[model samples]
Target: MLMNILSIGSQGGWTVAIVGYSIVFLALVCLVIVFMNLPKLLQLNLRKKLVKEGKPCAEVEDLNIEGNVNAAIAMALHMHFNQLHDEESNIITIKKVTKNYSPWSSKIYGVMNQPR
Candidate 1:
């Protein structure tokens, strides 16, 4: 029976894993659904507010920002973010280090003696 297989799976930690996975999956699914409809939900609220203020539905429903304006906004954001120019005083420093007796630099202990 299908119940036998269900019992076997339930006895292991598979049940907990499956339950947690399903919970997360369902939560993400719910989030996706809400996000997908979020714009519509906001628009509905805006429409209601507009109607309450005696504005017609047709104009309110088809409201859109112009493409050129949107592009300009996008370009401005891009320029603002991608401003890679940093003010710098062109200066460089070089130093040399020498240690005369470091154990790491000494070669005396590096050789292994052969066994006869």
Candidate 2:
């Protein structure tokens, strides 16, 4: 049965190829359509949720330039103070490490010796 199927002549091969390609292209087109509309659908759902929550559908604009200026000034002051500070004398140091490996310490060699 496998040999019979594999022995499909030139015309049968072309027919199978065309059908397979058509199915793949049709699936791709369907996916493209769904993806293209996905963002719009999500936005509509968001708008609906916002409306249900009594929030405005329109986006709010940030109008406070003074707040931004105050934040910038605060950051600058913090950086200036940090730069003027001195480092502490206390420090941490790694002293020593020792490693000892023995054949009896590991079971990997025993497992490797087992027959598959």
Strongest candidate by lDDT: 1
1-116 in candidate 1: lDDT tens per residue? 98776777447677788899999999999999998898788788889988999989788657767669989999999998777666567898788977788887676656573445
In the range 1-116, model 2's lDDT, one tens digit per residue, is: 97777677864786788899999999999999999898668678877887899988774223224558989989999998998766676898898877689888787778568776
In order, the Cα lDDT scores of the candidates are 0.82, 0.78
In model 2, which range of ten residues has the least summed lDDT? 58-67
Q: What does candidate 1 score on TM? A: 0.48
Q: How much is 90 displaced in model 2, in angstroms?
A: 21
In terms of TM-score, the best-performing candidate is 1
- Taking all chains together, each candidate's TM-score versus the true structure is 0.48, 0.43
Q: What ranges in model 2 sit over 4 Å off?
A: 1-10, 60-116
